[model samples]
Target: MRSPLLGVWERLRQGSTSFLVDASLGALLAGWAVVDTLAEPALAPAACLPAAVASGSVALRTRAPMAMAVLASVGFLGYGLAPGTSTPLWSFVTILVVAFAVGAQLRGRRRWAAMSVLLLVTYAVQILDAHRSPGELTWGEVFLTPAVLVLGPALAGWLLQRARRQAVDLRRLAAELETERGRYAAAAAEAERSRIARELHDVISHSVSVMVVQAGAAEQLLPPGSPAREQIRAVRNTGKEALAELRRQLGLLGTGGDPAPLPGLDDLPQLARATGATLTSEGVPAGDTSPGLGLTAYRVVQEALTNASRYAAGASVRIRVVHRGDELELDVANDAGRPADQRGSGRGLAGMRERVELYGGSLDAGPREGGWRVHAWLPRRSGSPR
Candidate 1:
């Protein structure tokens, strides 16, 4: 309700300002004519009335500028023809005002035509008046008055029109900039939400997989005082480890808490052992790799194993990371005999692709032969070999 009321008020204010600007110009011209004409004693009282009325017509100049101009010209002519009327200087002021208004409103050829007609008519009136009076028409008075009266006003109007057009263009450009800003803001917000969702998914999925695996192992090894007691204790330790990691990760997402250190490529071996997946590292030592490359390597393996355990329950998976020149390459493959419908929806693969691409890297994942494969390559640093 408040917004609607404000909109109405803004519209009203704009309309009022436009009206005042247009009407004020008209009123000024009329007032000038009144002051100039009243100064001459030779002009009759009736002649002064037409000159005064011509000034008021300026109020309608913007709306019906051409018509108001015609009206003012006709009034000036009428005043000139009146008996006892001296040279009507005030009449010229109204004609000039009308000439300027016409040029401002009319465009191109029409504007030139209006200006030409105004000059011709005003000069003709001056010439006829001089012919009837005792004074002879001098070149300066004949040419200068009409030029000043018509061209001066027309030039002013043309400039004002140009200024108004530039202002309108500026407003349109500002609106477009504002719209683009809003769209970018919305896109940023959506991206942040997506990152949070991915983080939550990773934490939850990893915790659940560890819990299920340990529970299954404990159940299978449960017996009466057998050597399997050691295996059961191992299961308890695994469960506790999984729970502690889950709590730490979840706390990072809580209010006013610092984020836990992210599990990077260096943590891949621990991740594999925790998930009960037979894992082997065949590349350079993790400590020798850069932090960025290690992080990417870790996330890829983590997402891959999570998907394999969830979808391909009993499948043996092979994970490999290789440092070749200035590029780090990764490949995770699983030969778990599972149908397409049994596999994860590939969101982890998509997230891996996004993460790799941020570092100007490439990723590929698809069904190959009888199994699925995920591969990625990330540049080591600036100016590193591709």
Candidate 2:
């Protein structure tokens, strides 16, 4: 998608680049030999047989090198013995490329051994000017020349193969390094956020504690049943509630101490009594519910009760929990009443929403029937990722 050349390259590689290059070279060289054969009267159409074999056999250098070696063995033998004063350099270059391919691409000694024999037979019997008989063939001509010509190109090909392997290994290492770098960045970001949260918690806790103590002192100076005494008492009570909520939230963030377990269905009765809310349930007993669903149920009701106390004090609050086989449903609602203090950061609703979603559930909080309502649907037995 990023580059048009990437698509072209994929097509070329799939077609086998080595086969294409070798086949093209073979066609050009064979065409030259065919033209030379047509020019010479002595070398008729029959002499072009070896040229045809070499042309096609060169294409299989990588796919099937042994097959090419077998065919080239028969083809070059005929070309060497063909009626001519001498052969051209193209014929020898074709043989050299074949020898190099065998050494570089194949895995076993048998292929190289076969190639060595082919080189010897082709060199010894190849058409030459003032041709010598078999007995006149010297040791230097037999071993030394063939060794130099065959080994030189084969060594080059082998070195190229090694360099290709190193390039592939380096690419793999670079990809792994990129993955590790991303993981480290994520860990550092999370640690920084936690550090800021702890700092904020300390500052806010100290300030709120000081306000509660001063309010208590103010109440002591006032007469019993005075209008100012009640206001001071409310300030002290609100500060206590804020501290409790702060501790609950910090506990959820892995504070590394003996943290109390979150309230659940089993503690709903006590929670209702403390908040002056009524609780009703259906379908399943508290002990039969999964811990994750029960915990979510308790939190939803606790948040709804806190909201009612803030905005609709002395109102009728009701908590309902129902188990419908595969799912658990919760609904908390309050009747319209007097508006009390309107102070909140609104984090309780956000926290309850996120906590429910972490268990793959949903929370719906909004106004209903002139009062606020929070309804949540949670799947039974699903674990919380938090």
Candidate 3:
């Protein structure tokens, strides 16, 4: 439940272009009108009636600028030349604010033309008001007063408009850059998948093919019905199947798929064994994890394990994964290697961070507790905030 004042504030926030500032200016002028009226001999507020009305035009300055300017200026001539009580202070302020609003609202040649008409009318009001009661006003006051009354506020409004346009242009440029960055990240992930496909073709596939050939040669060297010959035959058959699987994967990877759902969390234990790291998990894994997020998490852990293997060789490395309902947390820490030594070049870590962040998660790799640690908090669903 919102308080009445809060609801009013929310309405104001959703109001016109310069609603708060104009409203504040209007309020200040209205208060000054009250003060000026109380200073009269009869202490009558009615003397400030026209000023109060003009102040309202100032409040809705940008809502209908040209119309309000016309009304505030042309409508003000009668009060300006009136010979009785002095015009209320708010009316003068309203003219100035309205002039400023009109200057800021219109653009290009049209602004100058509209401002010209507004300036002439307001200046006439200023001059008439001055001539009617010059009370202790100097010669300089008469000459410079119209300029202050019209030119100053209009110039300030023009400056403000220029600044606002520059700010808008800068914001647009920043948004474009952000969108470009996202495209680059996506391209990088695609490139990595294609590269993996190439490695499997050039390295693993060729090795498996050669092993199959070599196993056939070895089986021929062995005597018929020998126990070792059967084993060699099984090895050759397995290598052929692996080569076929690699070709199948290449079809997917070569076509711009993202990471190809390679080696997700379920495969991390074998990865831990290969890299000589202890693995631990907590909480039940969510069944609905997106392929993109699962693949990103796998790549992050793989990079960490590889770094630990290369830099911390004989150091104790531990990999921990925790399922927190909507997100997953992975921590790879080595107890012996220095953070600086473990994070050298940072190319691999940077790629991992980009992939993780593309899915709207965070990656932090640094030294911790006399060791180095790579920490990643990833959402279970792709692109969901963690």
Q: Which candidate number maximizes lDDT?
A: 3
Instruction: Point out where model 3 deviates above 4 Å.
Output: 1-13, 16-28, 34-49, 85-88, 130-143, 219-230, 255-386
lDDT of 1 by residue, 206-249 (tens): 54565667766776767867777777667767766776676566
Give the Cα error of residue 356 in candidate 2, in Å: 40
lDDT of 3: 0.74
> Best to worst by lDDT, what's the order?
3, 2, 1
Local distance difference test scores for all models: 0.71, 0.74, 0.74
Please give, for residues 1-386, the per-residue lDDT of candidate 2 as tens digits: 47989988886689777768877866776787677667778675777887667645677777777777777777766766777624556666777877777776765686567567666656665424226445555556655666666677667767776787789999999999999999998878666555445543554565678789999999999999899998999999999999888777766665544333545778989999999889888886534554455666777788889999999998999998887777788899998889898899789999889878977889999899888899998876643333
| Candidate maximizing TM-score | 3
TM-score of 1: 0.52
Q: TM-score each candidate.
A: 0.52, 0.51, 0.54
- Model 1, global lDDT: 0.71
Worst 10 residues of 3 by lDDT: 255-264
RMSD over all Cα atoms, model 2: 20.7
Residue pairs whose backbone atoms clash in candidate 1: 30-55, 265-294, 265-298
Q: Count the backbone clashes (under 3 Å) in each candidate.
A: 3, 0, 0
